[model samples]
Target: MTVRFFNFTDGQNVKLTAERGGYSVIEYQSDMSVNPYEAQLAYFASKMNVRRRQLVCHLDRFPSHCVSMQAGAMQWMSGDVQPKTGIRGAGDFARKLVRGSVTGESAIKPEYEGTGIVTLEPTYKFILLEDVTDWNGGIIIEDGAYLSSDASLTHRAEMISRPSAAIAGGEGLFNLGLYGNGLVALESSVPREELIVADLYDDVIKIDGSLAIAWSPTLQFTVERTTKSLIGSAASGEGLVNVYRGTGRIMFAPVATGHVSSASTGA
Candidate 1:
């Protein structure tokens, strides 16, 4: 297979470069990553647009950039909003407010109250996107799957209420697959190298940590505890397992340094 990179623009203020191959790689300047999407929503928005769900995905580790460069990328993100509906707020701005007791966060709240909707919150410190909560489409949570929808649809309600952990608590959990159209939130452990696609045939794949971010609703999952006989998982540490089988695309972190924030205790 031969691969070559080329730059082309349709003469808009926007220009992009794409690499060609069996499949084309088109990356907007990481700077304009959020803009093109907003333009698409704007051009296609409708009253029933409220029924069109938007599934937002964020990479836990944002693309690397230097001081000044990072600021430029964030500025591009700031202008990406073009919601014809609800009130919108900045994630960082909302975070500062959520962290602080500032009463002003409500000042920048979304412009409307019902139906047409757009809101902002952080899936992590890096990713932020507006999801059309009023839509009826079931959401596929890849990351920030914790965010919820206020739309009439019931599918995303699972994610809106719980994160990946919800699956364990009798709350039907899996990589959110939408049967109907509506907005939903998804959490993906690995976003850069993995994708969540659905296949008619069901297959199950499991991994170390909760790498199976999202999958179709048809897959069945079970938890298993490992005995001390299993190598490092038993001797050096503990082996906990989550087995998933069925058909669907699972997004897994290529590298599994699974850990929670290890804060130092003043021992």
Candidate 2:
């Protein structure tokens, strides 16, 4: 089959920002071709630094590296692609349903197989591709951060060490966990370039807010006071803080990074 794309492949409108583990991040340099009014709006949006970016995953038929994305995330696909709901049976579906309820993720993420190119919906949020192995083969992400992952990974709901602590920390009781050796895509308000990665060995790290985007599952997370005593905490002008103990890696934003609208927000 032969196909030709004008401004697209020519890099006039979009450019490849980064690629990793079969996935690529494409950033739009201009949004001036949608329509007359919309193009003008997009031009202004770009000037305001609100341009859209997209994620694309590639698969090979010879040694296929199938991927599962957030439900309804696929914008387009081509070249002998087949999609499945990732529902093996009724029991499995029930588990996933419960997991979705707790983790704030979709009950059934659709998986795409065979040789093809899968394009996900674009958004203003920054796109990140992380190596799961770098997190010791397991990582837990903040709610609504998940975007896509390799089909070989095991995705599940990871409960907090203390539910009350999670609530006190302004985080969910459970987080979405991705395990195995593969790449996981995430959407974040803070770009990966600005993330602060801290690795601890049998130690502790504390943050005054929920600035962490992802952390190793091996670490124990909790909510604690900045000082040992309530009087001391008040004197220090600090209250509760999110604390992570044990040996693990954490990627967090040094400053407060607000959330961006996501496709799977209400899904």
Candidate 3:
């Protein structure tokens, strides 16, 4: 089969950002013609670092390395690729339904198999690619951050050890968890360049908000008062904070001035 792709070559408006483990992040720069109003808006948007980005998944012929994506994320595909619901039976469907409910993800994420190129819909959010091995074979990502992942990875909804802590921290009851090996793609409002990766070894980290986008599941996360005493906490002008203890790494966007979301919910 012959395939020809345009606007992907050098000097094109659309360019590759990074490619690894069968996933490629393609960025669409603001080079297209637009109306005067749109031109002004795009100009300001570019100044704020907002741009269109897409995720591409390269599937091998082998079924073991197939890819699964959000229900409607696929924009287009080429080659002899085939998509399935990835449902084996009724029991599996029920499990997935519960998982989706808790994780804030699609229940039936479609799985693509065979050799092909699949492109996801473009969005203003940043596309991030991560390898599970880098997070010690498991990762807990914020809700709505998941885009796609190699089929080899196991996905589940992870509940916090302390549900009250989640409520106090302004977090959800559960998070999307990915385990095993392979690459996973995510959607983030903030670019990775602005993110801070904190690697801890039998240590602890605390934050006043839900700033963490992803973290190793090995970390014990909870919400606690800034100070043991409520009066002291009030005096400090800080209340409950998200605390992560044990050995692990967390990817968080620093709280800063300007327009930036405190967490990466892809909102």
Winning candidate number (lDDT): 2
Residue-level lDDT of model 2, residues 43-76, one tens digit each, is 8878866667888888772234589999889988
**How much RMSD separates candidate 3 from the native structure?**
3.0
Residue 192's lDDT in candidate 1:
38
- CA lDDT of every candidate: 0.31, 0.84, 0.82
lDDT of 2 at 61: 23
**TM-score result, candidate 3:** 0.91
Among all windows of 10 consecutive residues in model 2, the one with the lowest summed lDDT is 258-267
Lowest lDDT 10-residue stretch of candidate 3: 257-266
The residue pairs that clash in candidate 3, if any, are none
lDDT of 3 by residue, 1-267 (tens): 968776563546777898887888887678365688688888877677777777887787224758998988888899878889998799999999999998789999999988888888877777788989899899999888888998988988888878886786678888999999888888777788989999999999998787788999999988888999999999999888888899999998786423534322223
- lDDT per residue for candidate 1 within 1-267, as digits (tens), equals 332323422323222222111111122222222376575554443221111111221211112110111110121122123322222347645543442232111212221122211223212111212232322222344432333322222322222233343444233432333344333333233333344443435565645455544444444555443443557556745465555566544444545523323211111
Q: What lDDT does candidate 2 reach at residue 99? A: 96
Ranking of candidates on lDDT, top first: 2, 3, 1
How many clashing pairs does model 3 include? 0
TM-score of 2: 0.90
Q: After aligning candidate 3 to the native by TM-score, how far in Å is the CA of 111 from where it should be?
A: 0.9
